[model samples]
Target: MTIYILLLLIAMQLIGVYFFQNLEDRFYENFRDNLEKQAGILQEVIKDKMTPGTESEKQRKAIDDILNKLPLDKKNTIQIVDQESVVIATTSGENSRIGQKNKSPRVSRVLQGIESPSVEVSHKAGNRYMVYSYPIKNDGDIIGAVYIEAPMQEMYDTIRTVSKILIKITAAAMVGTSLLGIILARTITNPVKEITEQATVMAEGDFNRKVTVKSDDEIGKLASAFNHLAQHLRDALSQNEEEKGRLQSVLANMSDGVIATDRKGKVIVSNRRARKMLGKDIELNEDINQVLPLANPISFPLTEERESFLELNRDEDETLILKLTFTPVLRASREAVGLILVLQDVTEEEKLDRQRKEFVANVSHELRTPLTTIKSYLEALDEGGAMEEPELASRFLRVTRQEAERMTRLIHDLLQLSKLDSEKVRFHKQPLRLEELLEDAADRFSFQCRQKDIAFSLSIRKPLPRVYADRDQIDRVLDNLLSNAVKYTPEGQSVSLSAHRRSDGYVEVVVSDKGIGIPKKDLDRIFERFYRVDKARSRSMGGTGLGLAIAREIVQAHGGTIRMDSRYGEGTTVRFTLPPCEPEVNPA
Candidate 1:
């Protein structure tokens, strides 16, 4: 309040100064204007009388009469000089200056054809005067000039009196304003000071203290609001604690790892899952870059991206692939406060997704090859010349029929695989002679082996156990293995099928062949659908790549296990085992 009063006083003082200065300037301007008007009139009257080279007493008397008859003030003087610098006329008692070289510089300047005004002190009277001078022309020649002087003492005295009165008024206003401001400050500042003290206590975490209300005005309302704010702060802190507990519970049970960091990338919160996934317990306020595997340090003042993702593949005891999702924590104003990182293990998912893409691509390539061949052959037959030649047309028809058959086989294999994948295939399990199934597969492939001139052999160990298995499905598995053995074996190379009883009371069947073997790198994916060691050779021999995959599925369904071992450029061996049927005990 005091400061405001001081500012008001300063403003009043500035206004007083402005008005005083303006009044002084106006008085001087009016005085100069009056002198100019009088000078102009004098020039008109005397220009004809101011003749060059003329010194006449009658001319001087005529100018004096003209000056005396004018309505001039008592403190004003007017004089006229001729071209010879001799004063020709004067008003009242100034006739002593006539017929003399009136050598005033201002008057001489006017004689040279310039009109101007100036203020100077009168040495004799000790008072300031306004002096104006102008040229008088006769026949376009400056034959003489006129000079006028007016006293400024009266105008100065008036301005001085106005300034003293204005100063008195300004001083009185400042005194009155200061007294009122002090009274007002007593009412407002005391309440405000108390409220400020209460606020300071609140800042120190003491919300129990409240401001005392002494009046029912705005200050009283402010005190009431401060008390309400303290209550609200207490409630908010309690609710915040409850929410914090719930968040901790959720983080503890979450499957994915959760981590939170402040704006500087310092860890503020972490869960057990996050610690386990990172393989180290992260401490609070630790730099996030030190915890996560990063090729470059995370830059500060993080970018305003919506979110980000990172894939981390760490090869420690085993290959571990994690998908990390980063999201910024923001305030209501969309200001970033921190960061949230969620880690998910995606190793199996990535592997399965890759396999699915490969499966689709392989299917498209396989079907397109057969369909393209069929289309070409059919188009050839449709051309006029090809059908007219009987032999060529027969060959085209045969090739088309063969490709159609291949497509049919591919479709059938795909359906069989689908059923196996869904667990919809029912196995008619029974105890059967496993040796007889092996023998039948060898005999079925004997004709193909004879055509290829590959040696085929079968051996059944003595005391071979009867196994519990499916007849048709087991036959299918055996047929697939024997066909692959014979197909890959060179002419004169031997292919053998053997069945024996294992020490673990299971029947084992072994299919061995001296064939072009699988490479070591591809051995792991041998049982995957449509995975072939040699795609062109397999397609040419009418071999669907699903053979080995389907064979493995069938064997597993019959309570058995199947595996294969091969060395590049050497022989290959495929083996399987079926759980034997428990011996039937005699009924008690």
Candidate 2:
């Protein structure tokens, strides 16, 4: 397009210059011809008026009369010279050469009997003059010469005016031509511009868009081609959508969560797994704030140089963990138009991973002690020192038995935990009196409490509500709490077990001890399997550290909850609740 415009401008300039130059030459020629004719006529009048015997005054009067009668056109300057090559008369009221001689070669030649017609001479006035030298002839002899001089300033002036007019016309014509070219260029380039814009939109992945077909010219034909391409692209996109639907179906049925959002951080689609993880049927077009309230806020650092992750806590009241990843969806223009959120439920996976690591470390540690003892005992025996070290051997065997028992207990607890985790353990549910249960559990620990010189007390609110739970699991729960209380309490300190009906119609049992209370930091994690606040003390007291974890699991299985409250160096209280079940009314 630019090339076309440039060529048009160049052609217009050339034509304008040619026309101006031609007009200038023609104007000069016409003016020069008119001046030559006027000079010739003046010379004829002068020659006719002159006679060989004519007196000077009469001749001068005739010359004045003729000159006066001649037209005084603005551009003509007339002068007359006599046969003496001297000034004779001038229409401008002075001798033709008052201060100079008539030095024109044409005048001298005409005086010598050569009848010179009108001729052109360059003058000092910056214009050419046409001089007509006519010989004044008498009876068969040349007498004098009549010279007529007419300056060509009028012709030059006419040519200048015509040249200026022509230049102005040429300039106007060029300007008009340029304007027309601009209009034509717009007519052709506008459609091309529209096509370029449409193509850009398609490149941005908007296949549904098409250009407007406004004409039947080449530009219109290009638009039609672009629209056809858009149609094909739309069909391809439809096919891709079908494939995506199938893929989404597969993802929905899987255990992992799947979530996707648009550029505005609005939830566009989600699978069943995600819905389950969020514990609700999340709808499309919902903002992320409403869909996943517990998830971390989205940070749209599109211009940042780093990627980010969000740890979404779906169930703050339960054990649900969602790991969400944000990835930018870049278009062909390298712009971030949307983001994809991938959610994964890693709760159980993380738990199992922690368990695996702990298991390995625990097994290695558990085996090391026994192996060391066995190695030492066998080494002593191998030195043939059995006779002298029989008593030492007996003590070594006892120590070996204790280590083996510890390993067996650890394995048994691991197996129990596995069963509980897999839901393979059977639970027999029945209604039991809370007071009776607490009494039985306390009785079993009474002797141990006395052995440690610790006071054991039980506080029961009368008419306590009966709880629906597994009897054995509840018994284990009570046993663990009481044992923990006894273990942590100092000798002569008090351990209190209390049962009461909560306002929410649940049976709450609180076992508190004034012992070397757990540290504030360790209170939350005290129920984790193999997590002991005082590891040395727990091991010295023959604890496997799985009792509290098992207790929490069993209580949770019965739809109950357990929590601990403690202040370092003061006391610790372990509280648990079980929902009350309706009592069986006797027949009236």
Candidate 3:
């Protein structure tokens, strides 16, 4: 509106000024021209009356006659001066002024004949006038002069009136322009204002409010774009939240440790699993070396195709064998921006590999012992010892046979273990009464126990749940347990075989011996093939060291669990469990 007013005011002012100037100029020019024409008429009338012989009074009479006949207003006056520089006649008709000499510079200029028929204008103290001077001539000789003076007050008054009217017109134009400007301003600004307000709401995370479009103009398009942008931002934020949730879930539940780091090797993201694997109080931006020193040697933007492994021996009696993979985050230009480290715990796998190698070595050593002994005895017999001394031949032959039998047993146990490990031995699962198996095993071991003077006992709880197991496999399990008990128990000590129904629908069997118990450290590995606590004693007792291993394998094949618990110098208990059989339903 202000701009409109300014433009209107400026245009109106220029037009008013030009009109006023043109009008004022035309009015002054026309006024002067009319007054000069009147002066010319007076010169003609006065010149015609003037003759070389004509009297001054006659000239004065002629000028006064012309002046009286002239249509002059009150602001206009005329004077006639003779060649003598004297006022001869006046339009005022004053008797004192008719014959007096006019000493005015204009009249003197006319009487001297230096200049003629001149118009001059003057203004002072709000009074304005123009003067016209003409010479009266007879036969081209100046005889007298005529002068007319007219006030410009009426012309100035007309100009002032017109100027007042133009000012009013300009004011009206300004008012109209201001009102139109207001309308235009609202039309353009209203939609913009609404969009700004709604955009502010959207910025505050509210996308409900929509800006109203008033026109199909730029502002309306902006409003439409704003609405779309609001919705897009909302959707993008929602998707971001969903992806964030999924990522968090993966990080929290995954067994592997995930750590994301920046290009500077500063930790950026550390998931819950990573923190738990590292430390619960682990902080972000901690150096990668602090969290995983193995990464320090491998620079970002990995140069190798394969990742490396790290064996972290924790100080808290925990060992972590981690396989580490370093992946570089890249931009569109393939520039390295950061790194992601995936740490997979390989502790169990490494432990199993180590155990397998140790088992192979132990098997070789245990097998070589009996074979080497048998070979020595056979060589002694083949070297004529049997021919030279029959007694020596018998002893050597017996020792060799014993060793051969031990080897046979060891080979059988090895093959059994291999089949169990390969899952090639199928178990025929059926119901086997726990009490019956217990009684049968007790009777079989009773003679051995009596010969050694060791008290043997069987405690099978009545109405025990029938075990779900392979009948032959369970029998071997029971026989192995009782044999171990009898073999390990010293004379005068007691060995008890027991069975009961567990609350969890399983049958628990236990064989306990008051014998030279295994050390606490070796209890966990007592069932391992070729593992022994008293190697020499076991060999002397004709124990192959594979009994417990074979028994465990059979029990496991039958879908049961076996474990051993022992206290050094006190006793050892081997326990196993089998799922109970479903009760038989009788048909009516």
Pairs that collide in candidate 2 are: none
Residue lDDT tens for model 2, 1-588: 567657866886787678667876786567656655665576667776667577876777787788778775634555566667766566666653443567878778877766545355567667676555666555545545555566666666776787678778767876787777777666667777877888888889887766787778887898899889889988999999999988878877877677667777677878887787777887888876677664356655242222233344555545665666567777888777766666777777877888789967876776676667777767766675774777876876787778778778877887887788888889988878878888888888888999999998988987787778888888988888898889888898989999888877778899999988988779878888788887787988888788888888888888889999988877889999988877435211
What are the TM-scores, per candidate, against the unseen true structure?
A: 0.53, 0.47, 0.82
Best candidate per lDDT, number? Answer: 1
Q: lDDT by residue for model 1 over 545-564, one digit each (tens)?
A: 99999999998887789999
Model 1 clash number: 0
Model 2 misplacement above 4 A: 1-359, 374-400, 568-570, 582-588
Backbone clash count for every predicted candidate, in the order shown = 0, 0, 0
- For all candidates in order, the CA lDDT equals 0.82, 0.75, 0.80
Q: In terms of lDDT, which candidate is stronger, 2 or 3?
A: 3
Candidate 2 lDDT (Cα, 0 to 1): 0.75
